[model samples]
Target: MTQLTDPSGQPPYLRIVAGIRRRIMDGELSPGDRVPSTRQIAKEWGVALATATKALTTLRLEGLVEARPRTGTVVAETAPARPPRRPSPPASPSEQELTLERIVRTAIDIADAEGLSALSMRGVAARLGVAAMSPYRYVPSKDDLVLLMADAAFGDETYPADAPQGWRSRIELGARTLWAVYRRHPWLAQLGSLTRPLLVPNLMVHGEWMLSALDGHGLDPTTLFDIHVLIYSHIQGLAVHLEWEAHAEAATGQSEDQWMDSRADVLRELVDSGRFPTFAKVVGAFDDGYDLRLDALFESGLKALLDGLAPIVES
Candidate 1:
């Protein structure tokens, strides 16, 4: 409750760091204790959120604090002697240092760490420590930046020169490759839907790979493209939930498992109601509760899909 400040006129963030550091050293905040969050620090110190974030970053660099996923920042297990003070804001990169590739890569990193919803031009600029409008000078707009991000994300993996031999193996390779990209960047799946597909060139590279696998199978143009789309949709449909689950957890402060467990009573009521006998039997059959592993589901679905399409392509 006391005011936090240093008499020597240190910056506001440094003063906050000194206060929290004092608490940790004096055993007022023990190891594993939840330290004041950025929001809390901002409120208590009457400084901006950016300043609070910088204070925490400084503490983290010094090994005095660590961030836990669901849990906020906590005092680290050990606190070493404080490192020498650094400037409040590190020098921003020169204009010459800012390039389109750097901006796109930084934006992708933001979307990967925090969902795409958290991304913004200003936020990206702040992370880059540049002016608000700096990225726009390169990217023009967030939508364009997202397109570039998706293109880069999709281009991460490619088909090998020695193709997998069989058409089915080739198809599996392409599908799994795309799946890996989605798993790496879950936000990629949320970019476009079947009705309005993403038209990026790198994405088309994936499409080309899959279509080429089906190319010489003697199928007509329509059927060939249809098969390719079906396979793509299979990977993408399940992938859409990845980002959705992330957003749900952030919004509700509960993981998907926690949220499902919370609905046990409702699940029991449904079982007892007996309106859906098959659903009840399935739910009751699990000795240990089912763990929804997306990777396993992706593989299972891919196998089933390829099996079904085998006769069509082979015919």
Candidate 2:
């Protein structure tokens, strides 16, 4: 293959760095696999030797790759797929020395699997196998713990640089990302009221991205901000229901479909009682469907909103 020079407009190192990350994420490189060497990158990407080295250096600093003496360089094995555990650092004498990261991360896992209501310092401590007071040493209060947890969850997914071109695509990406994150940690959607935001930098970055997507759309500032608020509310409102259903199923050990079936059986009995034929017909028509799928509904509604906004944006 002919050696290619770096594209002129974009920085050579950054372009090279993006190419490597894309390969990793796209599964061209798997966990525990060897990453390309600087020499390999230079040859493959057709960039200068120095540019390739800088690309590798940036990837290493970002925790995407690491170097070993015996092995030249390999993709970092510390990502989530590798299963990182809390550092069982030898018990130190000073209890207060325990890092806040461990405490916050543990709490986040709990809130992720279980709902937010299940989280408490005692619960986090139980999970950590540490004394109840140990968590308090790191996090001052449950509110502080939750705030930190929200930030950590948001930090899980970073926005892709040079996102797809066009304003609508950008807004769709932001909305979809936010919705996915909240869906994963459903409790996060319910944490703060619209009036008082989360005060987390990462969450603010989400808002900033949304605001930028609205730029030059010809919407007034109030309408632009309100549109974002509406989108957030639509996603969060559905997510709360999703969390509620999951919690109900977990407590009762019944799948949502089964629970809905039982409720439908009750409704069928009412339908047979010879009153309200219209209601009976409506309920009977939808008996065999799956339970409410909130994520799908959120995506659908977001798309509809975007469709309605397109004409205005183009105008």
Candidate 3:
């Protein structure tokens, strides 16, 4: 039993489990033979001893191995016997057992893998393997679906009911949580234009929480609500680029770097020609190349915005 090279870089526990499973199925490790001791497995597989132990535990749980007192862990006697496989549960219609709740979840998955722009009622129905008109039972129109999706994503997260020690702390937490939700579903940022505002209760709850955070700042209710929308816009405007980048890559099968490389010569020549000295100088500041770190950009931009708003709060 020599250590095998793992190409996928799977976690050591999974690799170790995979190794043992391969040997058992190959009949190299016979049924009822004493399986390797955790120490022996550790040495042979070059994995940590704890990982080897967990591998054995997984095998035991799967009924492929067992521990016998005074005999150490051995392959289970029933290892070769095939267990009955459970049948998959049947799918239900969107109206029969299907609800708006279930339809929204499926839509979320589509937006998660593909960008939100890729989402359509027909696409969602195709995913459910149902007729295109079927989703209309749960969502009246594509606009309604988008609204439901936004609310669904917003609802998945819980806000801290207890206020932080300070307003700034409270504001930062809410902004960061909202940022995270958008990153999880990048299409969410595009939904913030206030065109009817989705009318979803969960998003309204999020807005309410933000308004409450600013209660003591002396801003009028309208001003406070406007400020919250402005904050959301700032974060979402930058985040929309993330969705664009994703969509571009998926459509063209080109990464950001690859896209830049394709246009590198033309861009470099244009900047270096001295037609735009300030643009050239600024672009040169990033010789190492610019990679978007969404979390860092969100934090820095939010902090700057908050700093700018401090005087407004005091006034």
TM-score of each: 0.75, 0.65, 0.66
In terms of lDDT, the best-performing candidate is: 1
Predicted candidate 2: what Cα RMSD to the true structure? 18.6
How far does residue 21 in candidate 2 sit from its true spot (Å)?
A: 38
Q: Which residue window of length 10 is worst by lDDT in model 3? A: 81-90
The lDDT per prediction is 0.84, 0.74, 0.74
Model 3 spans with C-alpha error above 4 angstroms:
1-96, 194-196
Compose the digit string of candidate 2's lDDT tens values, residues 252-274: 43345555655876777888997
- Summarize candidate 3's per-residue lDDT along 2-51 as a digit string, tens digits: 66576865557667776677788888777778887766777788765555
1 or 3: which has the higher TM-score?
1
Lowest summed lDDT window (length 10), candidate 1: 82-91
Q: What C-alpha RMSD separates each model from the true structure?
A: 6.2, 18.6, 14.3
**Model 3: how far is 93 from its true place, Å?**
4.9
Give the number of the best model, judged by TM-score.
1
lDDT at position 296, candidate 3: 89
The total of clashing pairs for model 1 equals 0
